[model samples]
Target: MQITKCLHTALLVADLARAEHFYGTVLDLPKAERPLNFLGAWYQVEDYQIHLIVAESVPADLVNSEKLGRNRHLAFSVTDLAAAKDQLLVHGCSIQMSASGRPALFTQDPDGNVIELGETQLA
Candidate 1:
């Protein structure tokens, strides 16, 4: 059988409030209605969704410390890379520019979950 599109990405967060601030406020992702009876928050981005599940502890192991972009990360396209970088800095989020010299950057949430933001053209 053929595989279907990705429904969502689930991330385990130690602190739900902090994770909400990062994904909901900082990144400006719209909150989605979570019907499940669990400690978590959901954010909607276009057709995709980000599910933040509350956990006792979050894993902070980085496979590639020097180049976070090379590790396991979720990537999203942005209109302006510079503005995105500025926004992340203003929120006190650390960032790492793509080593490949592309218009993109890697940053981590409060739980140390890597997220890549890349520039894309508006069609």
Candidate 2:
């Protein structure tokens, strides 16, 4: 059987409230619908859903420094990389430009999940 649909991506966090604030405020991901018994938060991003699960301990170094340009990361397109970089800097976040020289920058969440925000291209 071939897998076709991917429903959601689940990420572990130390605190649910902190994760909520980080995602809700920083990334501006809207709170998606979840079952009442669910213990975590669900955020709707485009056609996908991000589920933040509360974990006792989160792993460190999820973002590799050496392979940043070639590493695993969640990428999103922004209108302006310079503006985004400045805004992220305001929040004390580090921005790493793509080693390939593309108009993109990388950062992470409170739990150290690697994220890349790239400038969108207009057709």
Among these predictions, the greatest TM-score belongs to 1
RMSD of 1: 0.8
Local accuracy of candidate 1 as per-residue lDDT tens digits, 21-87: 9999899999999999989999999989999999999988899989998788999999999999999
Candidate 1 has its poorest 10 consecutive residues by lDDT at: 57-66
Q: Please tell me which predicted candidate would have the highest lDDT against the true structure.
A: 1
Candidate 1 clash pair list: none
All-Cα superposition RMSD per candidate: 0.8, 2.0
Candidate 1 stretches with Cα past 4 Å from truth are none
How many clashes does each candidate structure show, in the order listed?
0, 0
TM-score result, candidate 1: 0.97
Ten contiguous residues with the weakest lDDT in model 2? 61-70
Question: lDDT score, residue 99, model 1?
Answer: 95
